[model samples]
Structure formats: structure tokens, C-alpha cells
Target: MRSDGTLSLERRRQEREEAKLLVLRKRGSRLAFEWGLQQCVKSVNATPRLLVYLLREVCVLAGRLARGGRV
Candidate 1:
């Protein structure tokens, strides 16, 4: 009976450790997902501004070419 009790206690301890590890893994995955989502949002927000800058540069180059300014 004493040996059985000892085994039960050890089993409970192992289960608790497994639960803790599972929680930690879940939290890590959630944090990683959030970080990736934030990076995507930042890139999406910046894209339009980058496109506008490129468009302005292209317009300038075209104007220079039209003017035959040795572009």
C-alpha cells in the first residue's frame, strides 16, 4: 500500500510538470503569432507610402527624359 501511494504521488508530480510545459508552449506560440501579425500589419501600412514615393520618383525621371536632360 505504501508503494502504491508513492507511485501515485510521483505520477501526480509528473502530470503537473507536463501541464506546466504545455502552458508554456502555448504561451510561446501565441507570442510568436502576435509578433508575426504585428510585423505584417506594419508592412501593410507602410506599403502605400512606399508606392507613392516610387511613383513620384518615376514621374521625376519621366519628366527629365521628356526634357532631354541627359537622364
Candidate 2:
């Protein structure tokens, strides 16, 4: 049978391990959140380019209309 001191030490060790696992889980969740945020930022960055392309098309169509050409 283990002595009281030995039992206390074992309990402390288990608690430390549990604490470490919790820390690791928190870090993993934080990393996932950061990655998702980065993907959102990238998608947002593409919006201006799409708007520019659509604007150019509209301008070209307007020019054709002014020249008496069919759309």
C-alpha cells in the first residue's frame, strides 16, 4: 500500500497533466480561429478586383450605346 505522502504526490502529478492537456486544447482552438480569420481576410481582399472588372464592362457597354451600336 502507498503511504500518504506518496499518494499526495501522485495526485499532484495527475493534476499537472490535466492542466497541461487543457493548455494544449486552448492553443489548438486559438490557432484554428486565427486560420479562419485569415481566410476571411483573403476573400475580402478579392472584392475590389471583382468590382473593378464589372465597372469596366459597364463602361464598355455604355460606350457602344453612345456610338449607336447594339448592346
lDDT of 1 by residue, 1-71 (tens): 25555556545654554454446446764443344344346655433333443455457668888999754
lDDT of 1 at 68: 90
Residue range 1-71, candidate 2, lDDT tens digits: 26653556545654554454446447764443344344346655423333453455567768889999976
* Clash statistics: count for each candidate: 0, 0
**Top TM-score prediction, candidate number:** 2
lDDT score of residue 66 within candidate 2: 100
Q: lDDT values of the candidates?
A: 0.50, 0.51
lDDT of 1 at 14: 46
Local lDDT at 50 for model 2: 36
C-alpha lDDT of residue 64 in model 2: 88
